[model samples]
Target chain A: MIIAERKPVDEIVEMVSGVKRVLVLGCRGCVSICSAGGEREVEILASLLRLGASKQGRTLETIEATLVRQCDREYIEGIDQWAGQYDAIVSMACGVGVNFIANLRPLDVVYPGVNTSFFGGSADQGIWTEQCAGCGNCVLHLTGGLCPVARCAKSLMNGPCGGSVGGRCEIHKEVPCIWQAIHDRLDRTGRKEDMSRIAPIRDWSAAGHGGPRKQVRDDLTV
Target chain B: MSFTPDIRVFCCHYTSQQAIAEGLAGLKNDGFPPNATIERLLCSGKLQVSTILKAFEDGADGVCVVGCPVNECHNLMGSQRAAHRVLAVRKALNELGVEGERIEMFHLPRGFHPEFVEAVKQLDERTRGMGPSPFNGGTAK
Candidate 1:
């Protein structure tokens, strides 16, 4: 799921100025799953904005709607019929959803309600951490399942460096040494033999050093 | 004479608004406070708590949402969704130090304007006694 967080409320109110009728649109996809943009959040924000606007004696007509996926056309069509009634929309989806809403209608100004963060996994509920750099390399087989590129301070490609202190990285006391974690996981899985096979000198070309990569799924598309 | 109240009401179109003429007559008795204002909505089930909250935020002493009763929604279950939302928002308002009674919901079947007006007037009195929203407390203007 796409991990995201709400931009501060003040920013959104400022962005929504001069609007009389506003739609608070939420996405039930990634952003909802992550708790950044969802039905509840939209309502909460609408309440907050209403208070702010009312304090200024400016009344605003608000409509609340949630689409299955803001990034897709079919889901957005759910609210299309009522689009003209609203002056503008505050999209609770990620950046992709924001842009998609923008492209769908020339008249409505789409404002992002959340800051799109990264492609990551939940560390736990209410907590998420970055896991992939989209580095274009699948080296997990060599270092156990843990990602060295993301967890290691140096993004080291090899075994532990001198920075390993009592099994923690030098970058921060809280971070366990990535090499140690890799070693422990390999030992637990009895895959130590897999580590003996030395990874060849790092292939910089395949690892996005060669620039953008594209893979066409012929079967899936056709 | 008992003090009448101005209850801000949002009547759903298909059911409540469709029955407004009869409802006004039904509510013309002293049961409804004189200061109340009635607003219309596409569906009471369409009323999100934010709509109610914004009303409170807009300085309405209280907000009353009248929708088709649970089983009678024009959109089939829209009222149920609104009920669920009202419950959740009540919890939120409580947490924010706002009175839960400031936001309320009721079911209105088609042709039940009398019942609808009574509900609105009663709610208005209840809220007027509670005073303006704590968030936009009276005359914070």
Candidate 2:
């Protein structure tokens, strides 16, 4: 899932300054799952904004709304009835959702409330780590189901460089060497034969470096 | 009617809540003002950043969250999670120009009345120094 975290309150308050009425929009997608831009986070942000404005002797009327998924037009349209009433919107969605909202409402000023972090999953309760680089490629099958592109400090293929010590990455003591983990998993599963073959140099074009990439499913498209 | 600091406290069900309800009968006599309100939650882990900010938004001068000790929570990690959330809210409060000291958390043993009351008193005094929340006039602005 896409992971994100709320930006500092000072920045958010600054974005909506001088606006009496503001809507704090939340997404129930990845941001929500990470507890960053969910309904609860939206309410918290609105309340804090109110207090921030009040300290400046200004009245800030904050409304709260959470769409099922801010990345979708159908859900983004859900706020249409009341979206125009507010002077600005504080979006608690990822960058994609924030842009989607901005595109949908070109005239309305939309501010992002979160810093979209990475495509990852929860590591533990209230802890999330990057797992996928979204490189537009999948090589999990070749590396014991772990993507080196995201976990490796250098994104090395067939790694475990001379820097790997005791299964820990030399770059940072806290991080486990992804290559070491890959080797262990393969050895345990008796896929040792796969480890001997070196992986080919990666093609960068598929990773969206060429430009913004999009997918169209001819079978599903209208 | 006077400008007494209103302290809103959220107590975890297993420990602090039972402490206040069953053990601390003289809590009110021990410097707990009439404006101090106690709310019980099934687990302090359920506490969210919104809840603490809402208390201040609703005119609380200060807020305290009482949770179980580390590694001893009924839900195993509920208290630990609450501790982290409290710190996050404190950072938010500081950024919002409110004194981050307005909120605090304590790990109290189940039914430990003296410690609970002492924690409240300390927060109460700190809040008194901070004065009433700027967000409140007749109502939260």
Candidate 3:
């Protein structure tokens, strides 16, 4: 799922004016999955905007609409009939959904309510950080189920940098050294022997090093 | 078609609404957009998703939760946890077909009067946009 973060309130306030009418669009996909853009966020943001704007005595009309996936045309079409009712659209989806709205309705001004981030998982309830570079390959098996390519500060394939200390990355104490974690996990799993195997040099080419790559199955699309 | 949202704001005893006599002393601020009501919990982290949804069932237009500045939380990690809960609630909002924006959790210092004032005003505006919550008059029915 696409990951995203909420935009600053000040920035969002500036995006709308003569803004009596608004449609807060929520996405039930990646942005929602990551908690960046979701139905509740849409309401919270709408409330903030409404409260702030009304304090100035300027009235704005606001409504709520959530789609399954704003990035997909089919789901986006759910809003087709209501498009004429709103003065502007505040999309609580990832950047992709926001842009998709723009593509569908060129005349309407669509504001992105969140900042899209990279593919990642929720580390816990509220915290989420980057986890994948989308290198178009999976190498978790090479390391003990750890993706050093995504976790390591250097994305080092061979071993830990000298800066790694006490099982933590020297760059930032908050970050546990990814390489150290790998070693610990390997030892715990009794697979320390895998580390001795001369890991071949990574074929960077497979990671789109040659260029942008696309996978197409003619059967999937008519 | 219109839902008057109820809002619950979680404040830190140190810096949030509790610090200002206005939040408690001024609890009488014209009530909230029909269904809107403000309740002070021990800490923003005290907020549970179930508790928040209960407010919705009782008829709330939106819910606002304010916490201590990240590390400044009196309870150490309470504010952080609250923030995370807010994120989870946002996801819940998306799934439920209701605008998640209705629920907000923010952080404030001990004397964030300016921000506090701003947040209240924002909450008011958002409720207005929602017009009138459908539960406005029917909750008792």
Better of 2 and 3 by DockQ: 2
Candidate 2, residues A1-222, lDDT tens digits: the string is 999999999889898887999989999888999999999899889988998887677889988999899888898888787955899889999999889988888888889999999999899988999999999889999998998999999999878899999999999999999999999999999999989989998898989999999999999999
A17 in model 3: Cα distance from truth in Å? Answer: 3.1
Poorest stretch of ten by lDDT in candidate 3 chain B: B132-141
Identify the runs in model 2 with alpha carbons over 4 angstroms from their true place. B1-3, B12-28, B40-46, B68-81, B134-141
> Candidate 3 vs. truth: CA RMSD?
11.3
Candidate 2, residue B14: the lDDT equals 70
TM accuracy, model 2: 0.88
Q: What is each model's TM-score for chain A? A: 0.83, 0.97, 0.86
Worst 10 residues of 1 chain A by lDDT: A48-57
Ranking by DockQ: 2, 1, 3
CAPRI class of candidate 1: incorrect
Q: How close is candidate 3 to the true structure, as a TM-score?
A: 0.61
- DockQ, Cα level, model 2: 0.60
**Proportion of native contacts present in model 2:** 0.78
Candidate 1 residue pairs in clash (backbone atoms < 3 Å): B6-B35, B6-B36
TM-score of each predicted structure versus truth: 0.59, 0.88, 0.61
